[model samples]
Target: MKQRLEADKMDSAQTVSAFVQTTRDKVSVINNKLQRLLDGYLDQLIDQETYKQEKNKLVSSKKSLEENLLTLERTQTGWIEPFSKWIDQAENLPAVAECGTLLEQKSAAKLLFGSNLQLSASEASGTAQSPWDFLQETKNSFKNSEIFADCAILEPKVGLEPTTCGLRYRCSTR
Candidate 1:
């Protein structure tokens, strides 16, 4: 996703830069024309009124193009803010899930699940919204899989062993 966004930004920056170059080329042409007009007036090849009128038009056009160049440059960087914000939030999510206070966890859950949270069958169930839904489905799919059979070994000890604790992990023939 980051790569995709970078590619998009590169493509747009190239387009904006191309336009700026074209505008600059036009300004260069206007400068040349203005210089020629002055030479023509000095050599009596054109009238003073005509030269003044032509110069004014070129100056006005050049100013407008310069302003547009500034605008294009300013707006090209606007994509960074949203991208940075997404990165920050995504990176912070796991930490919040693990150790953040109950309020923080609730806020994060609501952010991900929206109004889809539920307590069906006395189990926490929800349809995660949009992108997060895919991750939630992935987690659910792995919940019953035996591939990570050792994961429970890492669960922190919390209290005295319950009567059912030994019942869950029994030696069985494969």
Candidate 2:
């Protein structure tokens, strides 16, 4: 996963570099064309109207290219680091499940499940689409093991009586 992330980051960097270089080259070509247009107008080789029209077109293209280059430079390095951090943290879910507080666990569930979490009178469950789905599947295999017992439980109940968290409860009929 780390290798894949590094490869993805490298690919993104290369793509951005290529994009910026291409835009700079295009701006250079447009500047040359503008200079040639000015020379033609001065030498009376081209009429005023033709010069204005051609210059406007070249100037617009140059502005667009410059904007694209700026945008690419500013945003290209933004998402990769955060994304890599997320992947690193995601790999430690079991530890988080083992030691994290209830609030932390719920936050992790929110991150993993997004809007797929559901709460009702009997259950608080996240959809199976979570990246943790494999963990859920294997949990039953280790149910009897002391180290795995707590982590194996996925859903918590939503009950009429609230717990300290104010929403969840662990209850069974007497």
Candidate 3:
């Protein structure tokens, strides 16, 4: 599984690199087109109407490409680092939940289940499923498994003390 994850990460990195290069190339091409359009207008080779239309198109394309490049660069490893960190800290979740502060526990929950945290009376009722419901489902689905089966038992459901109910209330819906 680790090898597969590493391979997938490498594939994603390569894909992002290719996308960045493609966007750069497209921006360069559009820039060249804009320059040519300017030159044509300056030399009186193309009418003003034609120059305006082509220039507008080139500029729009260039702007879009540049924005895409910026987004790609910014997010290249944004998710990967967090995911890798989560994997690295997977074993520490129990410790974090057991000994860590309320804030740390919440932070770990957010990292594991994303930010769809909700605090309500129903969740504290214990009749309502915990946020780690998916882990339960996974464990149920793979009862004989050696990996996730253990993970299912790693952390007990966060207790519902009225004081800490507010803390346990912040759980991932999904």
| Cα-based lDDT for every prediction | 0.74, 0.75, 0.70
User: For candidate 2, lDDT tens digit of each residue in 1-174?
Assistant: 577668878899999999889889889999999999999999999999999999999999889888888999999879888867766766777788899999888888777777677888877776655455656565667766776423424334445654345423353311
TM-score of 2: 0.64
Q: Write the per-residue lDDT of candidate 3 for residues 36-133, one digit (tens) a residue.
A: 88998999999999998888888887888888899988887787776666456765777997999989987777766666656687552222134455
Per-candidate clash tally? 0, 0, 0
In model 2, which runs have C-alpha deviations exceeding 4 angstroms? 114-123, 128-174
Q: What RMSD value applies to candidate 3?
A: 12.5
Best by the TM-score measure: 2
lDDT of 3 at 135: 48
Alpha-carbon RMSD, candidate 2: 15.2
TM-score of each: 0.55, 0.64, 0.60
| Clash list (residue pairs), candidate 2 | none
Task: State how far residue 150 of model 2 sits from its true place (Å).
Answer: 28
